[model samples]
Target: MTSRQRSAPASILQGVEALLRPLAVFRADLHRNPELSGQERRTAERLARWLGHAGCEVFTGVGGHGVVARLRNGEGPLVLLRAELDALPVREETGLSYASTVTAARPDGRVVPVAHACGHDIHMTCLAGTAELLAANRASWRGTVLLVGQPAEETLTGAAAMLDDGLYQRFGVPDVALAQHVAPLPAGVVAHAPPGEPLTAAGAELRIVIRGRGGHGGMPHLAVDPVVVAASVVLRLRAMAVQERRPGEHVVVTVGALHAGERANVIPDSAVLEAIVRAPSLAAVDRVVEVARRVVEDECLAARCPDPPEFTVVTRVPAGISDPVAAARVRRAHLAVFGAGRVVEVPQGQASEDFPLFGADGRVPTVYWYVGSVPPAVWDRAPGAGPLEKLHSLPAAHSPKFSPDPVATLRAGITALAAGALAWLGTGPLGNGEIMSFGSLP
Candidate 1:
């Protein structure tokens, strides 16, 4: 590593240490007042205020509460840092002092508890700290940094919304877009996928309606039970992973929600099932969806339902693939900031992200990685002999009990992002003419 790169960590660490306390408070406030997808007005307002204070040109409402903060420093490659602004419809059960106690109604008029079970709060705070640190130390880097606060990520719609609203045309297409997600790994650690592999899986959400004939509880012979059909469909779908999948292929079919009847004695006229399917590629996702449709139809037909089941694909997103050159540069930067022991490579994950949409379908080079969030002590004491075993035992993202160790996670996250931006801006150890060559990648 160059002397400049070796010396950059000290400055980045110093800056992160100075901002840790305030950033923690900011993150806690966001955690306490979480907003659901597509309804992030208050969250956008807070992010805009923070960015404005950091001396960035703030633009709000680009695509349903998406905020863009632009920090221009002389003339260099423009880099975009993205984070999610929406929370999930889950009640907080972590028992932390800043756990969310908020509830909001969905667009369908169904009220549900809200919480940041996915660690978007941590992502936002890290982006905010990175923006502030870049603004404070402009002498170390020379480029335009775009800090994006995206909404509706949980539904896999926010990135597309922003792009359709002219995100790139308005703010200029960046040389590279950078983002990071928190995982259940040990705190103070960072991980990246192999060069050509996908960072996340391709995903689609399916909503199926099974129809039946309702009748009084006393008359058992009159009504066709859609609940029984739905249960059969669920079991069949689960079996597809083992029975239908190829030897080395990975596919996940999850039925997250099922609504059938209000009372046990009265049979409802219909049942609703909400499921999400994920695979490593779009073609695989399509195959799984087709199989799922067939399973549901056959089950309903076997049950002698009054009508065929209804299928609606709510959303579909492509897998997030990192650019080889960009990912290599960022990985080198991460290794420089946090020693070799702290930076490791992981396999492609099952969780899906819409962040790849920001890449404009490979038109722009993009880099995405993961930051460990589990506390070291907790990870060590967990019942497992190795990392993978322990990882499965811990509460993962989307779980109500999932909570990141604030201090260590925030520090590592800020450093990782700042170092990545600097690596592309031609200012850190990974800087110099070699890194700047990425601006010419086709």
Candidate 2:
């Protein structure tokens, strides 16, 4: 068969020509109205209105800004589809024609313009389109499809909040859960792995606050400056690279933010610290968290000052792993859509995702895939994002100049989700037992 004919599942391509325009609009509309994490009130309203019209029984106000909709056709496995509903705090750097028109006051008392730098725009749009397609043809499938629009992924609080609100309990969970993210990879291409390999992710954030007494800058002997204690903390954190921890385990600790002083001469009373840690396993993460705390405690005691309670070992993001069996189904769907050559095992990333909280029961398996969204110009220009600047850097996703090939990205996401859903439902002639199997391929 020709390459043109070797496209996604027929269920996706059948009405592709018709979905182009509206899908484009959906992407643009979302791009113009990016909302911050945990504060996705307006974003929830838009999703609610759309899902309501899509012939699904929609529910709103779930887990802060979350929205859940249910479409029941016949008795089959319940599938959960999730899309995050949050935006980055970046001021638009990418001067695209259709940039963000939404701006809100941030928690830190700053009013920053919001943009869909993380491609959540396409995610929401894809969920909407997928729901519409599947719901419109309810007769072709069985079982209940649960579509969830989660909030605050940027803060890594959405999924946790949703579950805290009884998402799985009241919602009756699912046999398999699926979600996809856009990558800075080549546009329109999809990357997903099968069971027994890498998939999705989970991790945490560390906030360390070292408090000390502030006095005259000149009198170093008198003032128990917190900055000095903070300095030791920084060095210890930096030293994690050389310091031996677990055997053959990768635990990354990055001190992203440090603040504690005012004026050149005056010392501050406290220093606040924030860092992100990424680990493939829960045990490794716990080990690192304990070590970090021990370091902070030791430093505080050595400084001869009372240890501040503000020095915390808080966790923001949870480690999300792609279920072995569920991942295989996603892999088959991606292969069918992007073809074998285009489908690949996504590289293990240090970046963290909170999708793990949804499938905590181990019943509703969630597999989050990546779709390449590298700006066409950048993709052609540089060899890659390189060592210094990355996808979520100031000049990448959060930049005003970071314009995505929205159509290309959206098409791949929609096709992936739609094809994934169809294959999940055991629709058409893909073979029911052969479609999604556990452990290994038959």
Candidate 3:
């Protein structure tokens, strides 16, 4: 590493620290005014406005509220830093002063509460801080920086939506793509999975609708009992991984939702199940899908369903793999900034992310890492405590109650992202007047 690179961490921290307060307030504002997927009109405009003031050439409404801001420095490779712009359809339970009380109307026309249950507010704030640092320290690193504000990530469609609308074609592909997700780890700590290890599993949304005859509650034989069939389907789906998957293969089948009858004494005509299938590989995901289809059909048939069961593949997203080389560089950068004790190893995650689509099919080298969001006091008090008393004490992402320590979490995020970006942008063929290539991929 260059002497300049060795000293870059301190420089980055100094720059980010100055912007921490505004960034925290920005995050709180975002948390207060959460918007749902593809409906991030206000969020996108707010991000664009900030980036524009930071000297970035901003483009709004790229792919239905996706924003792209470019800050070009002379003669170097391009790097993309991405952040999600949408929020989830979850009501706030955190009870914080900035907690979202905002409700948005879904496409189905039902109004529902919205909140940043997944910490996109923090992600966006960090992106803003990074933009500020990079813009201020342009002379320290030479390259084009593209800050992407993506929408609909909660639905796993935003990244693809942006790409389909010509994300790369319009602004050009990036040599390196960087993004960070907030985890439940203690504030100020950053984590990365081992090199070559999978970051997040590929995901497929499975929707099953089981059809049966409806009748009065007293006539048990007449009703066909679609609910029983639905329960059977759920149990079999769980067994799929154990019975079908290889010894070392990883898989998860979660039945997230089920809906059927509304009345207490009446049997419903059909039951619907919404499940998520996750696996380390696309083939495994495909296998799970196939098995799930057969399972639903066979179970319904065994129950003497009046009609064929309905199956729909709602959405499919590819697995996320960290580029070994890029990841190693980012890891080293984290170690430099936070020290060895604060930089920890992260296990492969079961949760799915559409961030991979930004570098779809490995078209761009990407490093997606985690930033700790749990308050230090809480994390410190977890030791010697039971799992339920400790881990369960803090709310996990996706819960309406999930809340990150705003200031510390924001600082940690800005550090990891800006440090990692500088690590890659500071070195390599790009800075030496050569282009970046994934070698075998392109």
Candidate 4:
């Protein structure tokens, strides 16, 4: 490492520490008032305010409720840092003082509790904090920092919406796009995928409608029950994970949502199933999707349905693959800031993300990593002896009880992001000098 880069660790930690209190408050406020996909108007406003306060040229409503902020400091390499602004339809059960009591209606007019169960609040807080830190220590780096507050990430459509709205054409294409996710691992640690392995899976979202004849509940053999067929399809799809999986290959097939008849006395004409299929590659996703289609068709045929089922491909996202060179550089920077022990290597995860779309299908370099969010004490007390066991024992993303260690997570995330940006931007005049005053948090 360059002497300039070596001298910045203490300042990075100190700057991040200074920003923790306000950032924690910001995160808690977001956690309490979470918004769902495509409904992040307030979230976008608050993020824009924070970015603008940090001296960034903030742009709001880029793509449906998306916000982009640019901080140009003489321009070396343009680094894009992204964070999700949307939350999940889960009721918060964390029991934290700032737990969400918010509820919103879905497009179908069904009300559901909303919460930041996936740690997007932490992501945005960290991104904003990083923007503040980089702006404060501008002399330590020379480049453009593009901060993106992407919406509808839970539905996996935000990245595409932003790109379609000309995220690159409006702002310049980035030299490197960087993003990180908060996981259930111990706080103050970061993990990256190994070389040549995908950081996250390639996945597809499908909406299937199984059709059948409708009849009264008293009739046993009169109506071809679509609900029964749907149940069969779900079982077969679950079996596909074990039956169709190849050696050393990972695939996840989930029947996330299902809806059928509203009354017990009536047999519905059709059953709607919302499912997700994820695999290490798109080809595998396709294979699993084909199997799912076949299973639905065969089950319908067995039930002698009057009409064919409707299978709609809602969306497909490619696997997140990091650029080798960019990954190595950021990994090095993370190690320098957090030390080698805190920055560890991890296997490719089954969870999927649309973050790879920022790469514009391999046209741009993208690097993504994981930031651990479980507090030290919590991790130590979890029912596990090893990292993997502890990870499984904790409340994972999308769970109602998933709560991150706000202070430790925000601190580590901000430092890691700042260091990664600096790794690409290169050190400036004051980079090797003493820590500069960060002014005050907004």
Among residues 3 or more apart in sequence or in different chains, the pairs in candidate 3 whose N, CA or C atoms overlap within 3 Å are none
TM-score of 3: 0.90
Q: What's each prediction's TM-score? A: 0.94, 0.86, 0.90, 0.94
TM-score, cand. 4 vs. native:
0.94
Q: Give the Cα-based TM-score of candidate 2 against the true structure.
A: 0.86
Kindly list the per-residue Cα lDDT of model 2 for residues 302-401, writing each as its tens digit: 8875555355555555556678776776766666656665565545666677887777666667787877776556565654244123343424554456
Q: Which stretches of candidate 1 lie over 4 Å from their true place?
A: 1-13, 431-442
lDDT winner, 1 or 2: 1
Error of 3 at 398 (Å): 1.3
Writing each residue's lDDT as its tens digit, candidate 3 over 1-442 gives 6776656557756877789888888888888999999899999988999999999999988878999999998878788999999998898899899889999898757698999999999999999998999898876778899999999888888888889999999999898898999988778877777678877889999888999999998897978989889999999999986787777888899998788997978989999898999988878999989988999999998999989999999889988888888887777777767766677665687889888887776778888888888888877676534323455567889998898998889888998888877776764211211111111110
Q: Which stretches of candidate 3 lie over 4 Å from their true place?
A: 1-9, 383-393, 427-442
Highest lDDT: give the candidate number.
Answer: 1
Worst 10 residues of 1 by lDDT: 433-442
Question: Is 1 or 3 the stronger prediction by lDDT?
Answer: 1
Off by over 4 Å in 4: 1-13, 428-442
